[model samples]
Target: MTTNENKSENLIGFNRLNEHVVFDSKKEMNYAVADHLKSNAAFLRDNSKNILNYLAKIASHHNGACGVLYDTIAERLSITKRTVERCMSELKQNNIIEVVKQYSKRGGRMSSVIRILPFVTEKKAPVGEDVGYPVGNESGPEHPKKPSGSKSQSPSEKDTNLSNPLLSSYKQGTVVASLLYIFDDFRNKGLSRPKFEEIVKEAIPEAINLKAYVRSVCSNYVENKSKFTNRFKKHCV
Candidate 1:
């Protein structure tokens, strides 16, 4: 038989072992079973299009289902553990496989029992539904009735902006915008307008840190008029 045929036969054998079923004849039936297995495997490999093929090969060696450690798989595949974890997550998301059980070790190490799904099967329910109900409790306890005459205060715009730095920085007449405006006033400023804008764009996501840094620098600049341009240049660069 060809190499592919041998691989198909091995996969079929492993799958049969998972189901705890025995077969008497391995000659005539093997060829047909191998062909069917080969076709399904090809389809999954093509459609899923991920590290699933490597994962499946490893699972096949352990009789179609096993508790696979991410570290071990990473070592064997010569990839990082994070990559293996991501690939496994993708496979789970696509319903190519399922985690049958989860095992945890001391020191908080964890692994999962992954079951290689058959290529052709009835449509299964979403990941955790088979266990019982959908994940979160739909019938959770309702909030207790509020005491009479107890009014809740709505947050002011200042309070809201303080909680979210992005909003705070974008508010009218904020120091962040003022810093940029003041810097643009210098005719021989080394930085281009585009470059300064780019820096601000990069800083927006990190608004809290930028806000703190700008507040401190701007405060110092206000006290020393000669230092404003030099300090802004240093900060921007």
Candidate 2:
């Protein structure tokens, strides 16, 4: 039963929760989830989307992550418990949220601690875990600092740009392209998807306004770039 159905058990239920408020608003959740989907080339149905957004909405009161039972979510969204399980499984499989099992004082299993990681926005990522969050990175790139008395990373290992996802030969190309589409006239001047990644590595080695720079380069590349950009963005939808 929900806390509202009980008078003295509000605190009891609240105790099982984890205070990991990641998304302040549902819109933030949407942007984060959208990026995840695009980056991974994943999809979520309407029902699954409903659950994900609801989790973010309810997280504010519970310090962000919802540590409620599947039945609790079923009741809130008016869905079946099994449906909640399936939707949650989908979210977990997507790496959008991590399900950390919580234990009670007596060591019994409590509601699972769901950490909907704050979407890494254009900010400096955490040192060890690379945990960057927030909408803009006014600061410089988040380079992993060297240990005391330790040698620096090899030239190949240094990541100079943390303002956005870095592109690479194998993995991060889609991620950079996925993020840049947000800006209008996001184009690639013969530089494949991942948006001037090769150029960033050699030319603009700092974490400057890559978004504006991208638009500038694309505009210089061709006129009526929005027509091409709109066409390219079709796949994103």
TM-score against native, each model: 0.30, 0.41
lDDT of 1 at 183: 36
Question: Which sections of candidate 1 miss by over 4 Å?
Answer: 1-50, 103-110, 121-237
Q: Model 2's lDDT to the true fold?
A: 0.51
- Could you give candidate 1's per-residue lDDT for residues 1-237 as a string of tens digits? 235434434533443334321122333233323443464464443323335554455455453454445665676567788877676776665445555432222223233345554333223445653311111112223334446663332222112223233333333212222244333333133444444444555544335566455434444444465577679999999
Please give, for residues 47-132, the per-residue lDDT of candidate 2 as tens digits. Answer: 67777766665554554455555666788789999998888888776556666554444545544556564444344345754322
Worst 10 residues of 1 by lDDT: 131-140
Pairs with steric clashes in candidate 2: 126-131
Candidate 1, backbone clash total: 0
Model 2 Cα displacement at 108 (Å)? 1.5
